[model samples]
Target: MKILIVEDEQEMLNNMRQSLEQELYIVEAASNFKSATEKIGVYDYDCILLDIGLPDGDGLELLKYLKKQGKDDGVIIVSAKDSLDDRLKGLDLGADDYLPKPFHMAELNARIKAVLRRRNFDGNTLVEIGNVLIDTESRIIKIADEKIILNRKEYSILMYLIANKTRLVTKTALAEHVWGDHIDQTDSFDFIYSQIKNLRKKMDKATITVEAVYGVGYKLEVE
Candidate 1:
């Protein structure tokens, strides 16, 4: 999954980013409101950890901006403001959840997982498509009732494809989601090709297929 963390505190932001990275999530960060607004305008994320107390602007306005644009990106307000009023305001403004500051990363992870589940998989941890079954929480995949193993990148690629199963996923989007900010350093999508090749081999026995669109992207189709 892809996430954007908006916080002005450098230490907290770094901590959150590192913790989420260890969980295999594609994470991006913005230390101030301007950067956050730019990213919010350009990309879509599975969830956003928004800190209402930004250095440049009120984080609540970012939430308002998202609502104005009719963006459905899941938002969880993470702030030091623990007042009931702050919580109500954020929820009323369209945040999916409110996490008070001084919270555990485990709790934050849990909240993000909950929002993603409700928004993407209809609150189901198990995603079944064709003959492939994925337990997202456990990060396990079973094809034809047989468990299969995949490397980290391969697993991430497969999940991204499955998430966009009904649409064509552009290479840029795929790379951004899997590699996060580090994708900017790569010159081409050769790594993606390699990963796709390996992932396809692992899923060769499954009813689902990953079909590449020449000069474009890829699509997940069922046989």
Candidate 2:
């Protein structure tokens, strides 16, 4: 999973990066509000650990902005504030959870897992679509009772498609969700088509169909 850590203290940020990276999570850091805002505008993160106190602006404002943009990324406030008002305000602003300073790294990790579970798997450890089952915690995908090994990008594509199953997803949406701001420099979307084709060929059951919409995009149909 990808995570963004927004904290002003350089030492604290480094510690957070080390702790999260040890758990096999891709970590990115931002020291202030401007840098955090820029990162949020570009990358697609599964979770964001934001400090409520920043050099330029309040983290709650950033949370509100993310919500306004209709981004469903999970957010957690990791600040030194432990007051009732602060926690309540952060929660009201759509924070998934709040952690005060001097927290154990293990506890933070647990909270991150819990937030991800609620956001992506409906609090279930496994995500099942038809005959395919994915263990979100284990990052394992199984098809027809057999385990299937998939590359990171392939797995991400499958998860994104399954998350919005039965909905017509445009190429631009897929690119943005997968590649974020970097998609703008790409010359063509043929690579997206190829990835979808490769994913379909790996499925054991042919019941699920990923249909193209000609000039638009693709939709996954279970008919």
Candidate 3:
């Protein structure tokens, strides 16, 4: 999983990055609103930790921008603001949870897990589709009781495809989701095709198939 932390305070941002990285998430951060806005517009994250009082803009406005763009990344407002109005406005703007600052790291972790559960995996730790079983915590994939080993990028690709199994995941979406900010640095989607080809080979015996849509994108088909 991946996360974006948007906070103006350097120390607070470091703390969040360290804590969430310890939980095995690929973590990235932006200290101000402009940087955060740019990152959010270009990349996709599994979750976003947004602070209300940013240096250049309010975190609530960031949520509104996300709404306008139709991105459904799970958001947890990690603000120093504890007012009921602040919390209510965040929720009304589609934040998954509001976490008051000066909170325990354990509590923050719990809330993030809850949001991810609801948004990504239907409240289950094990993601199963037909014969394939994935353990989100351990990042393990098992097909028909047989274990499979995948490198980090391969695993990320597999999980993203599984998450949007029913839809045709466009190449642009797949690249941005898996590669994050680094996607823009690449010349083409040859890396994406490489990962998808490897993933197809790895799961050849499984009931699911990854199909290319010819000039469009790819779709995961479950036999």
Q: Tell me each candidate's TM-score.
A: 0.57, 0.56, 0.56
**In candidate 1, what are the lDDT values of residues 1-223, reduced to their tens digit?**
9999999999999999987887689999999999999999999999999999997899999999998989999999998989899899999999999988876554576568668888997747898899999998889999999999998888988887776664567787788767875786788887788899999999999999999988578888888
Task: List candidate 2 stretches off by more than 4 Å.
Answer: 123-223
Residue-by-residue lDDT tens digits, candidate 2, 146-216: 88887777787777666556656677767765665478678987788878888888874745667787757
Model 1 clashing residue pairs (backbone) = none
Model 2: how far is 139 from its true place, Å? 21
- Relative to the true structure, candidate 2 has a C-alpha RMSD (angstroms) of 15.0
Tens digits of lDDT, candidate 3, 70-181: 9999999988978899999999999999988876554566568768888887647888898999888898889999999989988877776775565566776677657874
- Give each model's clash number: 0, 0, 0
Q: What RMSD, rounded to one decimal, does every model reach?
A: 12.4, 15.0, 14.4
Cα error, candidate 2, residue 35 (Å)? 0.7
Residue 156 C-alpha lDDT in model 1: 83
